[model samples]
Target: MSETNSQQNINTAVTLLERYAEGKRNFSEANLGNADLQGVDLKGSDFSYADLNEANLNGANLRGCDLSFANLSQANLQDADLRGALLFSADLRQADLKGAKLEKADCDRSTHFPQDFDPAQVGLQIKDG
Candidate 1:
């Protein structure tokens, strides 16, 4: 990515944090690709239709969040709390989910998980496509 593009991504991350801190949770259709957002608590937030490809969300709290149709490909979700989150049609291929809490989470058949990762193993509520 170009320097300007990288700077834009940084700015987006900062803005997102600020907005969340201000009691805002509707982040649908946000472009957060490659943005670093580790260790943030955003429970029950709305991130539907967002582009989070390659973003760093390690240890973030996303419980009960709506992530339907989001692009989380190659994202770092290590140790994140995603219990009861909605991930319909979300693309999680190649994403790191080590130690991530996914119990009670729900996903449609369109959701793409990492290789060898089973949603049923994690107690996810798998829905038919």
Candidate 2:
């Protein structure tokens, strides 16, 4: 990433963290790639089109979050609450979803998965358009 882009990312992460601390949870299209946000309470946040690849989101409260088109590849989402999350077209390749609660989360054919990953086994529903 360019230095400018890197700086922008840092600023965005800090802003999001501050807003989260102030009880603001709507963060649509936020660029949070590679950020360490483990154990954060972000329920109902809108993360659509956000780049969360390689981020540590373990144990975060992401229920009802809009994660459609987000890049979550290689992210640690273990034990995260993802119920009702919109994951259509999201890149989840190599993401650690072990023990994650994905019940009723929306995914579709456009959603990429890691090798041997099974959404159905984890109660993730496939939404057909």
Which has the greatest TM-score?
1
Off by over 4 Å in 1: 1-11
Q: Tell how far residue 44 is off in model 2, in angstroms.
A: 0.3
Q: Estimate each model's TM-score.
A: 0.89, 0.86
> Each prediction's Cα lDDT score?
0.89, 0.85
Residue 100, candidate 1: alpha-carbon lDDT:
94
Candidate 2 local lDDT, 1-129, one digit each (tens): 554343234325567778778776656556787888899888887787788989999999999999999899999999999999999999999899988999999999999988999999999999888
lDDT of 2: 0.85
Q: Indicate the residue-level lDDT of 56 in model 1.
A: 94
Over all chains combined, what TM-score does candidate 1 have? 0.89
Q: How many clashes show up in model 2?
A: 0
Clash list (residue pairs), candidate 1? none
Q: Could you tell me the lDDT of residue 2 within candidate 2?
A: 58
Per-residue lDDT of 124 in model 1: 93
Model 2 bad stretches (over 4 Å): 1-12
